[model samples]
Target: MRRRISVAETAPTQPGTTGSFTTGEWWRDAVIYQVYPRSFADGDGDGMGDLRGIEERLGYLSELGIDAVWLSPFYRSPQADGGYDVADYRDVDPLFGTLADFDRMLQTAHELGLKVIVDIVPNHTSSAHPWFVEALESPSGSPERARYLFRTGTGAAGELPPNNWSSVFGGSAWSRVNDASGEWYLHLFDTSQPDLNWRNPEVVDEFKSILAFWAERGVDGFRVDVAHGLIKHDELPDFEGITGEMLEGGGNRGPMWDQDDVHEIYRGWNEVLKAFDGDRMLVAEAWVAPAERLSRYVRADEMQQAFNFDFMTVGWNAGRMRDSIQSALATNRAVGATTTWVLSNHDVVRHASRFGLSDPSAWPKGISATDEQPDSALGVARARAATVVMLALPGSAYLYQGEELGLPEHTTLEAELRQDPNFWRTAGVDIGRDGCRVPLPWKGDAPGFGFGPSGSTWLPQPASYSELAADRQDGDPLSTLELYRRALLLRRELQLGRAELSFNASTGDTLDFTVAGVRVLANLGAEPVELPSHHEVLLVSDDAAVDAGQLNSNGSVWLR
Candidate 1:
C-alpha cells in the first residue's frame, strides 16, 4: 500500500556547489561552527594553536559544511579569563600569531567561502589593559576611568543594591581599586576582568570602533560575550519588590548584575553593527530564559542572534527537546525576532561527554587511566543524531569544533592544574571547562595532535581520540569524519533542514513533522510501534524495520 508523497520533488544541489556560502547570506540557514583558537590547531611549535594552524585547515572546515566559523578570542591579553579580558584589541597574541598571520587566516577562510566571526568581550577589560593600568596608577582615576563605572562606594540602601545579586564565580561582584583612593569597581565575571561603563559616550565609541575595525577587514559579525551584563542598574538601587539586590554586600557591590537600560546601550551598537551584518547578524551570549525579557536584545532592531541556551540543559527525551525548542522558537516569533541553538561551547563540558556518549560518566576521560572511553557505536550515532536535530530546527544552528568528527572530550584533572574559579569555590565540583577545550587531534596515531609541538599543547590530547585524528580519517570512507562530510553535504544538498519546523503534537512524547515532503517521526519509547501506513522509510534506529506497509521504530524514522 505505497502512497505517493504529495509534495513536489526538486532537484538537489550537491555539496560545495554553493561553492562556499558567504557568511552574510549564510546567516539565514547557516550553521555556525565555533572554534576555540587555543586548542584548535597549532602552526608553530609554541605549544599553542595559532592563525597559521587555522589557515592550514580551512579546507577541513569547508568540508564540514558550516556557513561560518565563530572563532574565540585571540586578542592580546594577560591570559586572564582566557583572552576575554583583552588588553589590545587590534593585535593578535604573540602565542597565537601576528596581524599578518590573522589577515591570512581571514583571507583563507573567505577564499574557502566561509564567514568568520570572532569573540567580542564587551563587558570587561583586563586590569592590565592600557586603559585600566592608566586608571589604576594615576593619583586620581583617569578621565578614562569614566570609561568604566568607578564608584568610591554606594550606600547599601534600596533593596540592598537590588536583591543583592550574587557574583557568578563566588564572592561579591565589586572589586576594590588599590589606589590612593578607596574606589570600588564592578566585575560581574572575574575581579581581574572589570566591567566597562557603557553609559559613557566615549566607551560606546571605543567599543563601536572595535566593531568597525574588524568589519572593515571582512569579518562578518561578532559573537558578543557576556552581552547581557553590559549596563547594570545605576545608583545602587534596590530590587522592585524585594528589599535588596540578590545576595549583595558579602564583601561585594549591590548592582553588579542586570540593569534595565542596558538595552539602550545595545541599541546604539545595533545601529553601528548593521552595516557589517548582512542580516545584521550579531549573536549575543544573553544567558537568560523567557524570550519576552530577552527579546529586548533582538527587539526588531537589536541583536541578530542570541545564544539559545534553553536546549543546552535539556535531556535526551523527545518531549524535553521539543519543549526547549518550542519555548525559544515560539517565544522569538511572538517577539518578532530570531535566535540560534547551541549545545556546547568552550565554557561548558562537551555535550558528547556530558550525555554519556563519550564516556560512562559526565566528566571527560582525558589522557588518563581513570577515564572510561565512550560507547563508540552509540557515541558516533548519537553525535550524528544531534547534528541532524540541530540542522532541522529553525533559526541558525551552531556546531562546536571537533563535534563534526565525533570528538570526545579530555577531562583529566591535575592537582596543581586547576584554574577555574569555580573549583576553588565549589569544593571539587564541576567548575572549569577543561575537557571540551583540549587540543584538536589532527595527525598520526596523533601528531602532537596537531595542536602544538610534541608534548607542548595547552591541554593533553585524549588517548581515546588518537585514532580519530582529522588527517587519518579525511579520505577514509568509513570514518566518522567521512560521515560528517556526507552529513554536511546532505544538509546543503537538500536545503530542507534549515527551514522553520512545523510540529504536530498530540502529547505522549510524540514528535512528527515534514521537511521538503519527507515525513519525520520519532517515538521516544522502549516498545515497538506502528507508524502511519503511507510513508516510505529512509532510515530507522534500533531494531525496528520498515516492512510492506507499516514503519516501526522505538527511536526515529525519516520517510517520504
Candidate 2:
C-alpha cells in the first residue's frame, strides 16, 4: 500500500482577538494530560495504574503542570478491545478499581485544581454487556434490542458482516450472533464494540443517561473515542477503496469513516454538553481529519476541541515543526476553530527513540558498544524540542504519562508479555503496544517496573527502566524528567498555549514565534542553531546548555 495522504492545508500564525477563539472555559487554554492507566504509576502492587494509584499520583500531575487529565477507559470490560469493550458504563473494572475508587479520584483531582476527564465509548457496549446479552436472546421489537444497532433479514447473511466496510482492527466490521436471524451487528473497531444505532431515539436518551452518570460522578469531561465514526450513512453505505488491510480476516466494513453524518451526531452530543454551559469540555479523537474538516466538529454548537496531531505526524525536523505549527494555526483559524496539540498517545512508538535521530545501526534494542545510546543527549534534545513546540503553540497542549519523564521506548521483546490485546490479535506480527503500556517506573529499585519491589504487577516490568524511574531523576537538575517539569511549568507560566500566534518564521531549526507578545522559539534539531537579535529569551528546555547567540542543541526560548 502506498499509504493514503491527507489533503489538509496548514494555517497562519497570527494573533487574533482573545474572546475571538471559542470561549469554552474548561478547554480554552487547558492542558489535557493523557494517562494510559495500565502504564502509569502502579498502585496496590498490581503493576497497574489503578484508581487509587492515580489518586496517589495527583500531586505529580499538579506539580508537572496540567489543567486536565484524560484517563483512558477503566470501565468494566473483557479485554477484547482493552476497556473499550465496555461491559458497563457506570462501573470501573476490577482490574483497575471499583466505582467508589473512581469517585474519590474525581473528587480529589478537582480539589487539586485538575479536571478529571474519562473516556466515553458512546458508540458501543461490550458484547458481554447485559443489554447486548439480553438482545442476543430477544426477538425483534424487544426493548433490549432497541439499545443497539441490530438489523435483520439480510444475506451474505449472518456469516458476512452488516456492510462492505472494514474494521480498523482488521477483519470484517460486522459479526453474526447466529444463522437463524440472518442479520449482523456493526463494529467499527473490534467485533466486541458493536456500533450503536445513533438514529434510534432510545439510544440517544440512554447515552444521555450514561453521560449524566459520569457528569454526576463529578467527572469534568470526556475524551470521545472515534467520535466522528458514530453516525452511519443511515443506509450503511458500501465502503470504497477497501484494501487487503481492510479485509484482514473476514468481510465487514464498519462505520462511515469521514462521512458528514458524523458531524450531525457530534452536533447532537454537543447539544448535550451545552447543558453544562462552558464548564464541560468535549475533545474528539479524529486521527485522519484535517483542520478544515475537523473544525466542523468544534463549532460552538458541536465540540469544544479536537486532538491536533500535526506534530505527531511530522518528522522530527525543525523546518517541519515550524511549518506544521504555522499550517495548523492557519488551517484551524480559517475553519473558525483552533486546535489542541497531541504529540504522542498509546498507539504510536515513543518519540524518544522513533525519530531515527541516531545512527540507524543502533536501534534501541540492538544497541552496540560503538553506537550512540537510544535516548542519547541527542534524543533527549529532540524530545525536549517537541515539548517546547507543543507548549508554545496555540490551544491545549496534551502530555502523555511517561513523556514528562522522557521515557525511552522498550528495548526488549519481553515487553510483549505485558498483555496487550493488540499483540494477541496478530499473534506476534506486530510489536504489541505492551511496550509502551508497561507499568510506570515509580521507585527506582522496586520490582514490577518500580510499581513496587517484590510487589505484584499486572504486566512484567522492564529491566532497564531504573535509570528512567522517577526516584532516580526527580532531583537531578539535568535529567530529562526535570526538563519536562520545566517545560510544563513554562507552559503554565506564560499562558502561551492560550495566546494566539503573534509571529513565526525561519530561525534555523527554531520555530520562532510570539504569543500574547511572549516570543517563543524551539530548535527541533539535535545541534542547535543561533538566531539574530530578533527577540529576547524567556524560557529554554531547562536541560539545554546554550546561549542567546548560539542555540546550541535542544535550545528553546520564549521572549518577553
TM-score for model 1?
0.84
lDDT (Cα atoms) of all candidates against the true structure: 0.66, 0.67
Q: Estimate, for each residue in 355-465, the C-alpha lDDT of model 1 and write its tens digit.
A: 554322232313322545455555444445555566556677888888766776665657356555545544544346666777788875545765666647876666767
Model 2 RMSD in angstroms: 8.0
lDDT of 1: 0.66
Count of backbone clashes for each model?
A: 18, 17
- Indicate which candidate wins on lDDT: 2
Which runs of model 1 end up more than 4 angstroms from their true locations? 1-19, 22-25, 139-142, 153-165, 237-258, 276-280, 357-380, 424-427, 453-455, 475-479, 528-557
Give TM-scores for every candidate, taking all chains together and pairing residue i with residue i: 0.84, 0.85
Deviation (Å) of 437 in candidate 1: 0.2
Over the stretch 1-560, how does candidate 2's per-residue lDDT look in tens digits? 22211111111122111111233475777777888876676667655678888888888777666778899999888977668899988888898889988888887887777888889988788899988898889876777777777775355434555557666655667777673675677776777788777777787788778887787667778899877666777777676744213232112234465567677766666667667643777888765444566667777777777877555766566665666676668876765666788766776656666554454212122222243436545565667766766777778778778877777666464533545544554454445465566667887776564674346666655566777888887857566676656556666556676677855556655677777777666666567476557655545564333453666666565555
RMSD of 1: 5.8
**Candidate 2, run of 10 with poorest lDDT:** 4-13
